[model samples]
Target: MDERIGLRERKKQRTREAISNAAISLFFDNGFDQVSITQIAAAAEVSRRTLFAYFPAKEDLVLHRIADHETESGRVLRERPGAPLATLRAHFLDGLERRDPITGLNDAPEVLALYRLIMDTPTLAASLLRYRENGKQALEEALRDKENLPQLTARLAAAQIMSVQWALSEDNYWRIAGGTSADDAYPAARAAAEQGFDQLAGGLGGFL
Candidate 1:
C-alpha cells in the first residue's frame, strides 16, 4: 500500500512538473494567451483528458503553483499553535530568509522573464488576480479561530496580510528589475520585508 501510494504521488508530481514546464516553455516562446490546452498537452506528451485531470484549464498549467501557495497559507495557519500574527510573520520572514523564488526577491533572470511574461499577458494577469483572491480567502478561513473578532474580521485580516505580502513581493521584483544581482537583492528585499512586517506588527500586535 505504501509503495503504491508513493509511486502514485511521484507520478502525479512528475506529470505536474511536465505540464508546468511545457506550459512555461511555450508561454515564453510564443505567449501565454497564444498557447492552448491541446498544445500544452502535446508538449507534455500527455492526453488532453489526462492534463485536465491534473489541471482543469490551460491557466492551471501556469498557475498551479500559485494555487498551491494559496492552499499552503491555510495549512500553515491551521498548524500554527501560537499567535496567528506571529505565526504568519515568522513564516513569511523565514521564506524571505531562504530566498524562496516564490517570494519574488530572487534575481533569477529566467524567473524575472517569467514574471514579465505574466505581466505582458492579459489572461495570465487575470488568472493571477484570481489566485490572489483565492489566497486571501484561504487565509481568512485559516484565521477564523481568532477570538474577540467580529464577523468579517477574518477576511479583513486576510486582506491586510495579502496586501503586505503582495507589496513585499513587488518590492522584491522591482529590486531585481532595477539590475541588482540576486545576492544584492536578497538583503534589500529582506530588510524591506522586515520593515513592512514591523509596521504590521505594530498595528496588529505582531500578527502582521
Candidate 2:
C-alpha cells in the first residue's frame, strides 16, 4: 500500500512538471496573451480538465514557484524565536545572499528571461499582484496578535512591511533586467533589503 501511494505521488509530480514545461514553452514561443488553455492542453498532451486539476489557473503554469514563498512572512511572524521583524529581515537577507529568485537577485539567464516574460505579460503581472495581495493579508493576520498592537496598527504594519519587500525586489529585478549581473547587483539588493526592514521596524517599533 505504501509503495502504491508513493508511485501515485510520483506520477502526479511528473504530470504537473510536464504540464508546466509544455505551457511555458508554448508561452515563450507564442506570447502569453495569444495562447489559450486548450492550446496548452494540446501541447502538454493532457486533457483540459487534467491541466486544470494540476493547476487551478493557467497563469500558475509559470508562476507556481513564486507562490511557494508567499506564506513565509506569515510563518516568521507566527513562529518567531525572537523579534518577528528581525526574523523577517534576516529571512529576506538570507534570500539575497543565496540569490533566491523571489528576492530578484538571481542572475541566471533563464531566470532573467522568465522575469522579463512576467513583466512583459499583463496576465502574469496581474496574477503576481494577486499573490502579493494575498501575502499581505496573510501577514496581517499573523501580525494581529503578534505585537499585541491595535488592529489598525497591525494592518498598517503588515502593509508597510510587505511593500518594503516588494519595492526592494522590484528594484533588483529592474537592475538585473537592465543588464546588471546578479553579482553586480547583490550589494544594492542587500542594502535595499536591510534598509527596508530597518525602516519598517523603526516606523513601527512594536515588533522590534
Candidate 3:
C-alpha cells in the first residue's frame, strides 16, 4: 500500500512538473497572458481534465509554488520552540544567510529571468498579489494561539509581518532583475529581513 501511494505521488509530481515546464516555455516564448491551459495541456501531452486536476486555474501553472509559502508562516508560528516573533525573525534571517531560493535571496541568471518574466506579465503580478494575501491569512492563523491577540489584532499583525516579507521579496527580485549578482543581493536581503523582523518583534509584543 505504501509503495502504491509513493508511485501515485511520484506520478502526480511528474504531471505537475510537465505542466509547469510547458507553461513556462510558452509564457517565455509568447507571453503569459497569451497562453491558455488547453495549449499547455497539449504541450504537456496531458488532457485538459488532467491539467485542471493538477492546476485548477491557468495562474496555478505558473504560481504553483506560491501555495506552499502560504502555509509556512502558520507552521513556523505553531512549531517554533522559543519566542514566536524571534523565531520568525530568525527564520527569515537564516533564509537570507543561506540564500534560500524561496526568499528570493539569490540572483542566479535563471532566477532573474523568471523574476523579470513575472514582472513583465500582468497576470503573474496579480497572481503574486493573491499569493501574498494568502500568506498573510496563513500567518494570521498561526497567531491564533497567542493569548490577548484578538482575531483582528492577530490578522493585522500577520499582515504587517507578511507585508514586510513581500516587500523584501519584490526588492530582491528587482535587484536581481536589475543586474545585481546573488553574491551582492544576499547581504542586502539579510540586512533588510533582520530590520523588518526587528520592527515586527518590537511592535507585536502581545501577539508574539
Candidate 4:
C-alpha cells in the first residue's frame, strides 16, 4: 500500500540522515581525512554496508548534504515564469534575503564550519568543483529546453552565469568568514549580486 511505501521511504531518509550527521560530526571533530567509513558507521550504529548503500563513496557522505541543490538553478529556471536571466537574478537575490547557505551569505557557525571543511579538504574541494560543472550543464539544458535558446547560446550563457554566481558566492563567503556578520554584510552582498547580474545582462544582451 501507499502508506507502507511512505513509511518505508521515511525510514530510509532517517537512516541516511543519521549516517550523514555522524560522518559530518566526526569530520568536524577529527578532520575529514582522519575519519573512516567504519568509524562513521559505528557512530551512526549502522553497518558499513548500510552506509555504502546510502552514500556510495566517502566524499559523498559530506557532499550529499548539497547534492539536492546541484540542479537548483535549472529547476528554478524551468519552474519560474519570466526571462531566464531575470528569474535567476530574482532567485539569487531572494536567496540572499533568506540567508540561504547556497548564496554564501549565511553566518551560522555550522554553515561556516562546513564551508571551511570543504575548502580545507582537497578531495571534497575537487568534488564540489565537479558538482558546479554538473550544475552548469543542467542550466544549459534548461536554457535550451525551457527558454528555447540555441545550443551554442545556451552553453555560452550558462558558462557566464555560472562564473558570475561562483564569483559572487566566493566574495560573500569570504566577507562573512572574515568576521563580518551576515546582517552587516547584507548591503554589500546584495549590491554585489545586483552588479553581477547586471553585468551578465549586459554581456548576454538580447539573448537573455
Weakest 10 consecutive residues of candidate 4 by summed lDDT: 62-71
Q: What tens digits encode model 4's per-residue C-alpha lDDT throughout 1-208? A: 9999999999999999999999999999999999999999999999999999999999999898878889889999999989998999999999999999988999999999999999899999999998999999999999999978999999999999999998998899999999999999999999999999999999987898
TM-score of 4: 0.98
> Would you list the clashing residue pairs of candidate 1?
85-207
Residue-by-residue lDDT tens digits, candidate 1, 101-189: 66886776777887788767788788899888888887887777543355477778788878999888877877777888767777777
1-56: candidate 2 lDDT, tens digit per residue:
99999999999999999999888888888998888999999988999999999999
Those runs of model 4 whose alpha carbons end farther than 4 Å from true positions after fitting are none
- Using lDDT as the yardstick, the better of models 2 and 4 is 4
Provide the lowest-lDDT 10-residue window in model 2.
199-208
Descending-TM-score candidate ranking: 4, 2, 3, 1
Candidate 2 residue 196 Cα shift, in angstroms, is 1.4
Q: Taking the candidates one at a time, how many backbone clashes does each contain?
A: 1, 0, 0, 0
TM-score of every candidate relative to the true structure: 0.86, 0.94, 0.91, 0.98
Better of 3 and 4 by lDDT: 4
Q: Per-model C-alpha lDDT, please?
A: 0.79, 0.86, 0.79, 0.94
Indicate the residue-level lDDT of 117 in model 4.
94
Over 4 Å off, model 2: none
Model 1, TM vs. native: 0.86
lDDT of model number 4? 0.94
RMSD values, in order shown: 2.4, 1.5, 1.8, 0.8
Of the candidates shown, which would achieve the greatest TM-score relative to the real structure? 4
